[model samples]
Target: YDPKRTRFRNQHRGRMKGKSYRGNRICFGRYALQVLEPAWITARQIE
Candidate 1:
């Protein structure tokens, strides 16, 4: 998600339940997530 353009990234947030994350997933390392506040993140989907 690009916080600079859209905070919610096409309306996505919170926990995702089975078969949902396949297309919508963000790869943030444990340390990154812990260090970077979700709001402060400029983007998601690491890969």
Candidate 2:
């Protein structure tokens, strides 16, 4: 084991079972883009 390196635990890809009710409104910025459909957004797309 390397003490200088950080290790992350494995996680399960759980179900996204329902429509999200939280954060439906824009809290910051003058403009916000809304997602009309479900999507698999990746980290590269966000950056």
Candidate 3:
């Protein structure tokens, strides 16, 4: 049982699910950036 590989597979599956759910309006990269940017800015401000 390779946990790392399993985790990667699960994440990949989730990304695919998001793509289908959004009807391809958001690619994975853009979706991730959209999600991360706000949190990233907030973390930077706190630092």
- State, as a TM-score between 0 and 1, how close model 1 is to the true structure: 0.16
- Candidate 1, 1-47: lDDT as tens digits: 53577555566467633333243444664443232222333456444
Provide the overall lDDT of each model, using Cα atoms, as 2-decimal numbers.
0.43, 0.71, 0.38
The TM-score that candidate 3 achieves is: 0.14
**Ranking 1 against 2 by lDDT, winner:** 2
- Which model scores highest in TM-score? 2
Per-residue lDDT tens digits for candidate 2, residues 1-47, read 75655576555767665555698788988997777666667999998
Structure candidate 2, residue pairs in collision: none
After the best TM-score superposition of candidate 1, give how far the Cα of residue 17 lies from its true spot, in angstroms. 0.8
Give per-residue lDDT, candidate 2, residue 22.
95
lDDT by residue (6-43, candidate 3, tens digit) is 53453332222222335435545544323322222356
- Per-model TM-score, in order, reads 0.16, 0.50, 0.14
User: Which residue pairs of candidate 3 clash?
Assistant: none
How far residue 4's Cα lies from its native spot in candidate 2, in Å, is 17
